[model samples]
Target: MALVKVFSGSEILAQSLKVRIEAAGVNVIVKNNIQSSNMAGFGSLGQAVEVFIEDKDKEKAAQAIEDFKMGN
Candidate 1:
């Protein structure tokens, strides 16, 4: 299955999103994991973490994230 980027944020936030999406039965992968370790620059502690899921599950994954953000 093809993967599509759904969100991007800090490592912690990406991991949190991953857990939530997976809990909803949607598989997720985190990209740029190495970038999360480098805090050399100012305001760069979070780094760039990309979250991806199957293309077919894009809508559901997005809704899950929205619901999560809405505290649903």
Candidate 2:
């Protein structure tokens, strides 16, 4: 799979997305070079990162990510 987006906040969510996209192609491109969001001063930040895989896997990845966040 190819790297698509790089983000942080929760690797679990990222892993779930990668799992769902395994059937397709593309993945959350997390690397040392990925620019991180500045939330140090922010009160609450949900889902610090967002990724997009193949169009076909988009739906599956989304659901799996949600489930993962829910401890599924």
Candidate 3:
């Protein structure tokens, strides 16, 4: 299945969103470019953490992300 990016933010926010999305029964993949950059001795310059999910779970994950943002 193809993967689709659903969210991009700080590392902490990405992890938080991952939990909420998984609770909605959608699997998550977190890509943390900030961490990679730090490991490579380059400081982050942008929103480097991203959350991704299978394209099939896009709708469900989107709702979960919205709810999380809404403080639900």
Candidate 4:
């Protein structure tokens, strides 16, 4: 299954979305550039973290994300 990005923001927000999406029965993977850079002993100037889900679950995940954004 192809992975599609559903959200990109702070690591905290990404993790929050991950939990919400997973609760909706969608799998999630988080990519944190800052954390990766820190592991490599390099400083990252970017603060963006990404949350990905399978393309097959895109519609459901999208609605979940939207609800989250709407504070629902």
Cα deviation in Å at residue 14, candidate 4? 0.5
Steric overlap count per candidate: 0, 0, 0, 0
- Give the Å error, residue 34, model 3: 0.7
Query: Candidates sorted by TM-score, descending order?
Result: 4, 3, 1, 2
Query: How do the residues 1-72 of candidate 4 rate in per-residue lDDT, one tens digit apiece?
Result: 898988888888888889999988888999899888989999887556998899989887787899889988
Number of the top lDDT candidate: 3
* Candidate 2 structure quality by residue, lDDT tens digits, 14-65: 6555665554443544332123434344343565555555445455466555
- Candidate 3 on 1-72: residue-level lDDT in tens? 999988888888889889999999998999999989989999897789999999999887878988878888
TM-score of 4: 0.88
Pairs of residues clashing in candidate 2: none
Output the lDDT of residue 11, model 1: 72
| Of candidates 4 and 1, the better by lDDT | 4
Query: What local lDDT does model 3 show for residue 70?
Result: 89
